[model samples]
Target chain A: QQPVQSPQAVILREGEDAVINCSSSKALYSVHWYRQKHGEAPIFLMILLKGGEQKGHDKISASFNEKKQQSSLYLTASQLSYSGTYFCGTEPDNNDMRFGAGTRLTVKP
Target chain B: DVKVTQSSRYLVKRTGEKVFLECVQDMDHENMFWYRQDPGLGLRLIYFSYDVKMKEKGDIPEGYSVSREKKERFSLILESASTNQTSMYLCASSFLPRTEDGYTFGSGTRLTVV
Candidate 1:
């Protein structure tokens, strides 16, 4: 099943922060975060394993709670380049990987 | 860095025509995936391959068939194209499960079927 993402769209000013949440009905083995710019491919951001550890890449970070089947992507001090659609892919088991609906984020100057 | 390459950036097809989207990965990954993206719908998986000649149906695969005759190449075939199938198609590849890295996606093919 596909994950559910919160905040279908978000607008932010420079230096602002935003959070995109993804929740699943089934337990997840890992959660993957990606960002896609206009007319571009989805770029990998971070991956969180089921161990409840947070992964960080530059100003982007994510946390995965295996027991709760929840994952959140965090963007701090948003930049203009941060404008794009964000997607979270979850692996419910060893073989199945599914994605959420997505969150459109626009960061203005 | 892994490179996932899609054959075409844009394509137009007529209704009832057959459509093919190709994807190739240079990273020798064990998994390849096909997904379609539409506004508000996010990315919907159509098919995936784990090995040469191996395949699995994704969430939305009714109108799509997949071919993976080679390890590095995966193809998505639309048996009979329809206007409703017009969308951006994306190809991706990743290592086996538990590799700790996310998928590498191709630039995408913007397919418009009229």
Candidate 2:
């Protein structure tokens, strides 16, 4: 089944912060985060394994709670370049991965 | 970096016409997937192939079929195009155990059926 994402859309000013959440009904082996700009393909951001670890890169970070089957993406001190849509993909196992509906984020200058 | 390439950036087709969308990946990934992106609907999986001649029906597989005759290429076929199928079609490829590094997606093919 496809995962669910919260907050369909959000608008923030430069240097602000935002959070996007994704939850799955079934147990997840891993969670992937991606961002897509207008008229472009989605780009991979990071991946969190089932070990319930937190990973960070630049001002973006994510946490995966295997027990809850949920993952959250944190964008700290958001930049204008961060304006785009964020999607989380949940992989129940090695066979397939399903993506969330996505959250639209707009960061203004 | 892995590169996934889709044949067309935009396409227009008439109702009842057969449409083919092609995807090629430079990396010899073991898995390839086809998804359709619609407004507020996110990415809906249509089909996926794990290896040559191996196919699986995804969540939304009706009206869509897939072909993977070779390892580097996977194709999506619309038996009879309909207006409702007009959307952005995305192709993605990943190594075995897809969650490893995540999927590398093609730029997408925007199809408009009339």
Off by over 4 Å in 2: none
Best by lDDT: 2
What TM-score results for chain B when candidate 1 is compared with the true chain B? 0.97
Considering every candidate listed, which one attains the maximal TM-score? 2
Question: For candidate 2, what is the total of clashing residue pairs?
Answer: 0
State the lDDT of candidate 1 residue by residue for B1-114, as single tens digits.
Answer: 669999999999999999989999999999999999888888898999888999998989999999999999999999999999999999999988657778999999999999
In model 2, pairs of residues that clash are: none
Report the lDDT tens digits of candidate 2 across residue range A7-81: 899999999999999999999889999999999999999999999999998999999999999999999999999
Candidate 1 CAPRI grade: high
- What is the DockQ score of candidate 2, to 2 decimals? 0.79
TM-score of chain A of each: 0.97, 0.98
RMSD of 2: 0.9
User: Which residue runs does candidate 1 get wrong by more than 4 Å?
Assistant: none
